[model samples]
Target chain A: MNEYTYPIIAGITVGTALRVFMLRTDYRQYPTYLHGKIIHLSLGFIAAALGTIAIPSIMEKEFTAVTFLTLAASQFREVRNMERNTLTEMDSYELVPRGNTYIEGIAVAFESRNYLVIFTSFVVTLCYLAINGWAALGAAFVCFVISSLLMSGSKLSDIVTVELSELSFKGAGLYVDNIYIMNIGLPERQDEILKYGMGFILTPKSFSVRSTIANLGQRQAILHDVSVTLGVFRDSGTPALVPLIKRDLNDGRIGVFILPQEKDPVRAKEIISSVPVLENAIQMPSRKRNREG
Target chain B: MKMEKAILAAITTQSEKVTGSTAVFHCETKEEMEAVAANLEAILDGIAHALSDRLYIIVKH
Candidate 1:
């Protein structure tokens, strides 16, 4: 057997094994179309093996280049297809939580080592033409190891997590338009939100108000336009009698109030003095208050 | 479970527009969702381990 024969055989073997593993493992975890892909990969390996065995060339350099490029192109296509499919899958869900449903994006990165192996393979193929004819085969073996490690490693961790919390919540369903946003933040945190998450979309004018309502959920509260006095006190000292007053505050205490603009200082001060801390405040408002108070 | 499935189906249908990729299976119930989540977690862990190995190989090489 020529030097190229060994490396070609090894590549076929490793690639075949990988294809098989992907096919057998939780195909259900992936979409239905992936089933066909699994088959395609298997066939691709067979073709690679055949190509290497059948093609005979004196140059050896020409043979190596042809084989490597073909294999690389095929594998690259597979990866690209998978990524495209994954993105399509992500698009079906309503990422913004309205009721119980949740969605998140998974971010996957290309393995640098895989690129390195591809580079190494090309270099080794050239080397095999020059010096130790057998050396190219050894390089191919190393490339396989590197590629496998990269394929099986951190690249997989990048899959996005999308979840739906409280399956029973009304309006908890997926929408077709929501797509996965990429390269924003950590996938894990996004996954957490997707799994047990709630969210709302708001226009620019009502963004703050909508966000507050989203956070509060269906909790009971009064809505008011009036401002309230808010006091920030140090843990040790007693709160000042005259609280730092902010006007037009929708402080949950005086009902769910939406302050349209900054509260009038005079009105806020008057309201703070008149209202008793323990009396008019809503139920459990004390618990909501700063313990330092 | 049915609800989860419905939600998943909705996501699957819509996923194409939103993500530009194919939608996988949906988790219709809490149990199913949890199972899928666990599987994904394991896969992620495996991937992480594999990356670390690859990193070592690169460093060595």
Candidate 2:
């Protein structure tokens, strides 16, 4: 047909491919269901189409068509809301619920991914129209690299050192590396806890990271991730057999107490270290302190 | 006006130690008191917290 036909198809294909690559269901297991995958893939296709068409419209002097990007913004925002609602609804039934902060971070990631798809498509189409098809392919490769770099946030290991700690009972209170977790009055319950429980102490690498790791949401995210990967040894009726994180007020270290069925300390430590530091929970107090002094 | 935590019941060998508002279960011995507390904890879905050697309060959290 027209000269723009090949470029438009190429852009759409690359953009949609980027979306598929980004939508990978990893340990988080989100969008794993067929329907969920279908929903996202369809949205990705629409985003790619919207992004690709903008270049040709601009070339043909139809400037008004570019305004559709604004509509794309609102649509992607809906994707965020959809993700939030679904995750929040499912969180309640989880053995160890992923708190609001983690859910929000996931929702934000989903929305940003669509925007990245759009960006990829726009750049690819522009390259094809301005130069040639091979240039568009090169641009797409660069876009993939940039998107991946942007997508990966800092992990827990970057800011803190996770060390295995002894879980001990100082009278009724459970202690993880001198940090008091909670009180368990019943000997039977205490016996069960001691049998199944594991402890870890997370020491912040820097002064600024102390506050970030201490966030309640960040703590819950760690517990949820560990429980998901290692299997929680708890049921609905058993409130005492719960995982907890307590802070050592004297130092910036945190005590993580979990009841994982799989009692492999090495794997547990690895899982803890790999948990994503939630974007919403990050705080850089040192930056402000540096500015003032 | 929702109660996140409250003492549902107090199981104690020393009935004199706990008083007022909350229902108290006066038991003959420490073993009996623990048994009652455990049952109550499972029933009410609360945590049994030991206040003293003679006292245990089931608090909903």
The list of candidate 1 runs beyond 4 A from truth reads A1-7, A19-28, A31-34, A43-75, A78-82, A86-145, A152-293, B1-61
lDDT of 2 by residue, A1-293 (tens): 88999999999999999999998988888988999999999999999999999999998999999999999999999999999999999999998999999999999999999999999999999999999999999999999999999999999999999999999988888999899999999999999988999999999999989899889999999999999999999998778888999999887999999999999999999999999999988999999988999
Docking class of 2: high
TM-score for the first chain of model 1?
0.31
Write down the TM-score of every candidate: 0.28, 0.98
- Expressed as tens digits, the lDDT of each residue in A72-169 for candidate 1 is 65665555455546545654441211111111111122212223434543445444555565675676566557655654432101211112112111
The CA lDDT at A81 in model 2 is 99
Per-residue lDDT of A259 in model 1: 24
lDDT of 2 at B24: 91
* Model-by-model DockQ, in order: 0.01, 0.84
Q: Please estimate how well model 1 matches the true structure, expressed as its whole-model Cα lDDT.
A: 0.32
Q: What is each predicted model's overall lDDT from 0 to 1?
A: 0.32, 0.94
